[model samples]
Target: MNLHTWVAARGGIAHREDAREWGYSPSRVRAAIRAGEVQRIRAKWIATSEAPPELRAAAAASGRLTCVSLARRRRWWIPEGASSTVHLQVGGNAHRHSSQAVLHWSDPLVDLGPRSLTTSIEDALAHLARCFRFEEAMMIWESAITRESLDIESLRSVQWRDESSRALARSVRGRSDSGLETVFVVRLRGFGVPIRQQVRLAGHDVDAVIGSHLVIQIDGFAHHSTAADRGRDVAHDAELRMRGYTVLRFTYAQIMHDWDGVERTVSSAVARGLHLPPTERRR
Candidate 1:
């Protein structure tokens, strides 16, 4: 195939022969950059695909497109973006790119498990945690799991420097839930609080179990609050308690905004109830 065909199909080309095969000399490649037929991918590369409008925006605006946006483009999973960070694959030794972007050059691309760009699943989920809010990360992480984004190889391929990050990546792939449930689970995980997602207990499917001690209920406050709702919740809590489960209730607002407090409460309760030494906790 011609150089342009090859580049467009490939998205990135750095070699000189590939440029020459496009019926253009090296000077012509430089001239085209000056003429604007193609945009240089940084100082040393080119996007042969003509950079789709969004990709161009992602490339130029942030120099890295990560988390939900990358997932959306690559894996087709849409996620909320509350000032989420975009990530690029600059090697650990690469100089920091200046673009108001929250760059993660240290975390090399491993294998997003056959994702849109073939980045590693650990890499993808790590990017999610680094760039987006806990809520957004949770949603995408859970969605990715439900959709099989977290293959064993991809999770194993995660690259991180800190022990916490490495640990989080190891376990992130197995948790999956609805969009809101995802938010709850992610925040819980972020704080290093143990949680079991989508567990069946007390004739109700609890959203999460914190260290096998407490059940976190992500109740929709909008629909709840009626007398019947309170009655149901109380009954559920009693049933769960009878079966050795502590019920920690959180509304949507509590889950989204003050998850730290929620985590503190749950983690403390878990530590006390499960007899886990405080330091043995993973967070």
Candidate 2:
């Protein structure tokens, strides 16, 4: 294979040993770097200029992508407030230098050898469980399953290394459409409010329903962006209101950046008896 194909096949980066295994001489690799066809990551790794930033970072760290970095690359929903650190998984015995990146030293379930720039989906989820808080970890886990990046059956059989990891595994329901929805669910769980997720009401599937008469909508950018979609959503909210249900809508920004405001709004609605069933409201 040519340099472009070789680099592309290996996630836009390759090690000197990989090129050597493919019969590329050291001089040829050096020539490619000089000719601007590829850039040297360090003494041993080389990458095409078109390689993604995460891959380049992994190459610089002499590590493979894992945890949140891998999750973001695979388009899984990353929870709000998740650290921006570049997460990498190195060997348990590997000597690592100090850097701004977060390094994990656990053995992988499926080894990607030393030069691979990305982690397997299973390994990513495992690392995510160990790295993040329970709610944030479950959000990512469910989102991965929802996106079909990892299969539910495979998740069931994977061996978890700790109680927290096992608990995260058991909590995977694969239902939340976005990280915002995951936050919505977890935040409401503490209120002792009986919530029905993905419930059909007034010809629309809402994000959640609290108690009996409160319909909550979470507007992620993808699902509710167009003008006509917004109009339709407003109409649905009106219809639900006409049906005697109190409707509350929260955007991705509101839930992520101004959570105190969001929680206060919900709490006030519940305090006003808006979330209760008609019989409870009357009583």
Candidate 3:
């Protein structure tokens, strides 16, 4: 491929050495720069005008994107109202960076190669634990687990540097189908009721099961937007109800924005023994 196409294929930015290996000589690279096809970044990286701003900023600052910035790029679910600031991981000795960007100075959890413009997923999760609250960080981590197919046991074995990272590694079950599910599970941990996630019941995989008979289904917009999808969900809820399961469905807004109401409804259901089987409730 030609220089511009190659650069664009690599997300509109690439290392000079990678370009050379791809058969572009130094003179050719200089010609491309002179012709305004690509802009040189700190003598090692080059970017087209269409490059992502966060990536270009990372290259300019000689840092790798990490924390929520990288999580956003990877399409990981982040908490609402999380900071939009560009987060970069720079070497402890490096000094130059934009004041508006948040710079992480700690050592990376994994080594980044020369051509890498972003931190590894492990490093991103580590930084996230430090940058956000526990619940928010868990949301991102569980999203990563689902999106990246991360092995939970392997994650727990890593030598995470921070107490937050260690706690996250130990606590993450990796069973959440979405970040919202993770939030629901984490927030209800104190109920002292057994909670199982991704449980198969009535020939369908429900979101979570509280105690034994309480089936909680969380609907995210991406999955429940279409009329057909909503119809299918309603049918499933009817089937689950017919099978003696106490189904509680919550929307994305109710879970994220109206948690108090959601909690109260759930607490009432549990207190009334709706989560118990008929025999158990009668006893």
Candidate 4:
């Protein structure tokens, strides 16, 4: 296959510099783009018509599938917006690419070993951790599990000792409180409240959402996550309130220790918002 085909097969170039190494004059690259033989996905790389197909093969073979595409492919993670960049799990031996597909670096030990890269449902969830902030990542995690994208083997396929990996694993366990929330689940349970875990409502979801009371939201501490997610959260809550729902948000810290307090507040707000009498709410 030609260089363009090869790059396309590899899911486009990681960046523009890689294109130069392929020996295409700048003008030629632009001309190819105009002719529709190639396309510039990101500033860095030119994608040949075949790039997407190549990316799929490489992702399966590279053994480290990125969350953005994997999530879409495996139905693992879902987000409100389309991911602009592609995420890949690459090892030391993997050569650099000349495409906009952003490859994530990792040191997998054996082909199927802890250090070896892998392609599976879990990798998609793991990729979300690296690709987005913790809060957003957890949302993907919750969505995957709630949608059943995560599997028992997929969980084991993860290398937990690593911080990012571990955080993701923990997050999965955290949001999936269906009789399995603690180590993470405990905090939610301690409220002496009955939580409807992984429930969908009015086209939005709540992790351990309380019915007939209040809606509780859990947030993680991903860096640079607040400002990015704030407006979206407000809008989401506004819609929920419009639907006759009262929402209460809790962060990781609140869930960790003061969980009871958070629950109490939720319970109170839910009761008050619904205008239910005290005895009626405890049920």
Clashes of each: 6, 0, 0, 19
Model 1 gets an lDDT of 0.59
Candidate 3 clash pair list: none
User: All candidates' TM-scores?
Assistant: 0.49, 0.81, 0.94, 0.45
For model 2, how does the per-residue alpha-carbon lDDT over 1-283 read when each residue is reduced to its tens digit?
6676788787788888989889888998888889887889877888887888877877777678899999888888887567878898877543366357888877788887776788878888888988888888888888888886566666877887777778877766666767778888887788988887888887789888988998889887565467987788889989998888999988878887899999999999998899986667845
Over 108-145, each residue of candidate 4 has an lDDT whose tens digit, in order, gives 32345422233555556656677777655665676567
Instruction: Please provide, for model 1 over 1-283, each residue's C-alpha lDDT reduced to its tens digit, 9 standing for 90 to 100.
Output: 5345556666654344456765668787787667655667545455655555444434443334555556665653454334434445434334454444455564445533211222455565676676655456556666677776456556656556555446555555555556667666655555565667888876878778777656777774344477987898789889987766667777767666776787677777766664243445456
Q: What TM-score should be assigned to candidate 2? A: 0.81
Number of residue pairs clashing in candidate 3, backbone atoms closer than 3 angstroms, sequence gap of 3 or more or interchain: 0
**Candidates in descending TM-score order:** 3, 2, 1, 4
- Candidate 2, clashing residue pairs? none
List residue ranges in candidate 4 displaced over 4 A.
Answer: 1-64, 109-118, 146-158, 173-194, 198-212, 215-268, 271-283
Error of 4 at 251 (Å): 21
lDDT of 2 at 213: 93
Compared to the true structure, candidate 3 yields what TM-score?
Answer: 0.94
Model 1: pairs clashing at backbone N, Cα or C within 3 Å? 85-131, 111-119, 111-120, 112-119, 112-120, 112-121
